[model samples]
Target: MTDLTTAFERVELPLETPFTISRGTQHTAANVVVRIEDGEHVGVGAAAPSRHYGETAATVEAVLPELLDVVEEAGDPLALDRIDARIDGRIGDNPAAKAAVRIACCDLAAKRLDVPLYRLFGLDGERTVTSSFTVGIDDPERMGEKTRTAVDAGYTVLKTKLGTDDDEARLAAVREAAPDARIRVDANEAWTPREAVDNCEWLASYDVEFCEQPVPAEDPDGLRYVYERSAVPIAADESCVTLADLPRIADACDVANVKLMKCGGPRQAVEMFHAARAHGLETMLGCMIETNAAIAAAAHLAPLLDYADLDGSLLLDSDPYEGVPMPTGLVDCSALDRPGTGARRA
Candidate 1:
């Protein structure tokens, strides 16, 4: 057994701009930051809970004490699997809370071993994917402006939020703004299969890389219907939450979009990525509006992803922590010059 101390606190982070998706608009993100200390080293992580996944800052805060207790009781940050199994046994859900703990443990484990998080995972820092800067739902003109701003900021990839009434106009505006950037679109379960199929045709015409979650997660058949007919590739975000979801969504979508909050944490995300590949699906990692403490850990898994939408920290007005550097939207693991996940107080 080892000595481990743990704590968590909730922070309200204002968005750089109001972030609007298909469901609603968010002015601020409520994140619960978790910290685990083993005498000399402190491991940091954060939970950017989503109501769409049935979690909020309140839910994450409520469960974190118990989760941290499990970590403290385990007393071994390196025993990640044991601690994770215990957390799952204690709580039936609250993936974001569990993820915060798991990320802390992973961070501590890597730091104790005197290695970067990716090095611990045996991932080559050289092999990496560029992340996509997301343009949240806004008026077409504003969306165009956001696209232009991102392009000027050196982002080569962009993900535009859709599911609006005038999605075509919005896409047109973004395309006009960033004509050469690699673009992707997310409808966020707002379309019927018919509408999705039709939208995919236009998405393809605009040179969109993929269309994400056009139908509701509950409608597996509808997802498949769109997937089988869509001119643009389909990526399953809402439908692909856990490892068990791989087989279910494999034939229905071409890509699997996994998030740390939805899947538990880094270890679980690694499992899901391998499983997604086994199921013949391209792997992607997405995130909610988050701080660097959360997004940094996710960035270490970049070597495993075919696509990445980890612009969560970038969307914040300011963050107290810093993680891996994503220069011009690239998940630049090569620039991680510190141990652990490179998440430290800024």
Candidate 2:
């Protein structure tokens, strides 16, 4: 049996570009990369938790010591099993950190076995997934100009950030700029129930695909109201963090947005996907600001869902490790055919 042990390393890579939003700012991305090594085999996972989801670099950093101990004690053969068992309760409410460790272990395990991570989930290697490029909060003209650039770059889908005074104009500008591109909007829980419903209705003029997290997470009733009133579909982001949140969220949401960080790990994400499907909810795979490792893990789940928002890595100026190469709004899953996550630590 491989003697698996977990190790943590911090990486700081500049964004090939910077992504700005209403929440705050991110320059060079910082993430903690977890490595699970069992003798000759190694698995890698990377995670970056955002403040919008109630996670920060300092918190992820502080949690690593405890995670290392958990991996060391669990050993290689049972490393993932043990990690899965304690992930939810021990990690408190921060799913992002636990997800990072889980991904690393899976990557290491698959690498050891000389197989791809998706194959472990019983998925074939021939699936292609399309991703969405995000347009952060900015001036309407600038937002429109960015949208035009992205569209010209061959991004078929665009996700625009809203939560400020200029949201209406921004949406209009982007629509005018990228007339043929599929558009979606995410409010990041910035709107109230009424505001969400009202804004979503206004957005209908542009024919948006859906509106995500229109209202605050805790306001399920408000979400339901927005869903019923809005012309476009409503996808729940902050509102649906766990399986438990699904039932309540499903009542109000037309779709569920699943983020590996918010869902805990790949295993839990799969579980949630199953539950969301069972509830007859359309599903979207979302991501936080992360490296290719986390983005790759999330991409594995995209083939199993209807919508994907795993473009977080593209917003970064530089990716430290080479795993899955992101081509704008689509994922080149050709790399996923290899063993592990196809990520090589730098």
Best by TM-score: 1
| lDDT of model 1, residue 340 | 96
Checking candidate 1 for backbone clashes, the offending pairs are none
The residue-by-residue lDDT of candidate 2 on 72-155, one tens digit each, is: 666763356676776554668777888888888777766766777787777755666678899987889988888988898899
lDDT of model 2, residue 101: 84
Runs of candidate 1 with Cα error greater than 4 angstroms are none
Tens digits of per-residue lDDT for model 1 on 224-285? 99999999999999999999999999999999999999999999999999999999999999
Per-model TM values vs. the true structure:
0.99, 0.93
Candidate 1 at 48: error in angstroms?
0.8
Each prediction's Cα lDDT score? 0.94, 0.80
RMSD of each: 0.7, 1.9
